[model samples]
Target: MQQPPPPIFPIFRSRITCAVLTHTYVGDKEHSITALAAATGTDSGTMAREVSRLERAGILASRHVGRTKLVRANHAAPFYGPLRDLVTIILGPAQVLSEELADVEGIEEAAIFGSWAARIHGESGPTPVDIDLLIIGRPDRDDLYDAAARAKSRLGREVNAVVVTRSRWEANKDGFIRELHSRPVVAVPLPHGNAA
Candidate 1:
């Protein structure tokens, strides 16, 4: 199973293809329903339904190994390349960010809080051109920024990061923090098996 980076992706208003597809497309890896659920912040039932729909449409292919069914993008599907390219171009941020942040140390929690987050929350608007990241913990500034720089390079979007101590994050009752709490904040999951 591939490591997960975020809890969800409300991209394109479809939790269907946006998150799950990008992940399977990444590394051309096969994924089980459980893995897909974890990757997309969804339950197995949801993933199973979506997977069945995509499979019927020939957009995805799957087979069972005993009781575990493994799924992946159907390379044989028509227009597969173009569709993969399109999704990766438009919805690649989550996967890219996940890979970039997986090894960064000192972050107790990380999340996206801005236009992108708004879009993920189903708000109607123009597509966001940047990523607004909030890091709570004392991670190395240089490492964090460097990872952001690399992500920007890969994503063709600027990544702006704000750092706040966990104490301040818990204690500060400022407008900025209030606004963040009021809005839809997309929580980025920490790398699996990494000690927080």
Candidate 2:
């Protein structure tokens, strides 16, 4: 007889674990399981089941508040610190890239922007797209282009970069792109800061 496939709840649990760890602080503060389910694109029932599983594993704490059940991170959880550290380390490259670009003459600041920034901020889903950079500078046109090309070569991935003069960035400070340009960052260094 053919065996039925393993329940889909476990798959949802695993996916939610990564998403929540990467996007939420998960300590003391309460979070709605429904919201978490929406964030992870999983159904509420599956999220509730997985939440119970995680609770048993000491990764989460749950309580009923009014008509809603609020779930939160248990600071006493063994994997809390390690999971947080993992997310930081994984996101560090974007910061390193920003710092590297900031070193170029005429560049004032550089940041991972657009969809990449949204993903980092937990406002959107991850995409298999090139990293987008918002660079503030007034370098010579050739220098700007060359810098981006070199960054792509050194990083082993194509960087979709947009370079704007400091003045332009300042003038358009309220714009969406400018907002992304100033978002929070993570830093990562090359094997040695080498352009190779």
Candidate 3:
């Protein structure tokens, strides 16, 4: 399943599109309600109920695959483009970047630190123009650069990725690492794994 970077909007504000677009942009083409729930940080029961509502509104469509039902975005819906743009362009980079990086082999752990993180943590400042990432592990530098480039293009913001060896990260020896840990840090989950 495609993993969406977490939504920036209050979950309650855009819960419907948050759930649907996470599936549309970052999710697998079709997601079981349970998977969608987990992806959107919503409980399974709530996701099911919301999906039912979207289906009624024609924003999403579902089909039965045996006893399980899979839901996906209905591109044919009139609001699809606008809604997708809202998530993909305005409110989706963090979610998308986190999800995309999670799939990169050798990227064991990742976190966001900097202005974006500060804003999320309720610090006031000029809007952040870039996302600062602290990546832990020995991922291919070229691959990491490529991913950051793509994300930058898509989000219209810089994605600065800093790599640190696991040993250094664990030891907390570097002053930069120490300072980073002191700030707001939002952990990004690795694929099929807990937040790292």
Clashes of each: 0, 3, 2
The candidate that achieves the highest TM-score relative to the unseen native structure: 1
Expressed as tens digits, the lDDT of each residue in 1-196 for candidate 2 is 2122212111223445654543344222577889888866778887788778878888777789898998876667777776544433343335336444544556555566655555555453555255677666554556656766765654445677676766676687667756654674322222322221
Runs of candidate 3 with Cα error greater than 4 angstroms are 1-20, 98-105, 118-127, 191-196
Model 2 clashes, total count = 3
Compared with the true structure, the alpha-carbon lDDT of candidate 1 equals 0.77
Query: What's the alpha carbon RMSD for model 3?
Result: 5.2
Note the residue pairs that clash in candidate 3: 2-28, 5-95
User: What is the overall TM-score of model 1 with all chains considered together?
Assistant: 0.79
Each model's C-alpha lDDT?
Answer: 0.77, 0.56, 0.72
Provide the lowest-lDDT 10-residue window in model 2.
1-10
| Residue 26 in candidate 1, Cα distance off native in Å | 4.0
lDDT of model 2 at position 96 = 37
Clashing pairs in 1: none
Name the lDDT of candidate 2. Answer: 0.56
Per-residue lDDT for 1-196 in model 3, tens only? Answer: 3233333444423544554565655443788988887776777887788788888888788899998998888878888776666556545656767766765777878888887777555566776778888888888888888888887876778899999988998898789989987898767656754323
User: TM-score per candidate, in order?
Assistant: 0.79, 0.42, 0.74
Candidates 2 and 3, the one with greater lDDT:
3
**TM-score computed on alpha carbons, candidate 3:** 0.74
What lDDT does model 3 reach? 0.72
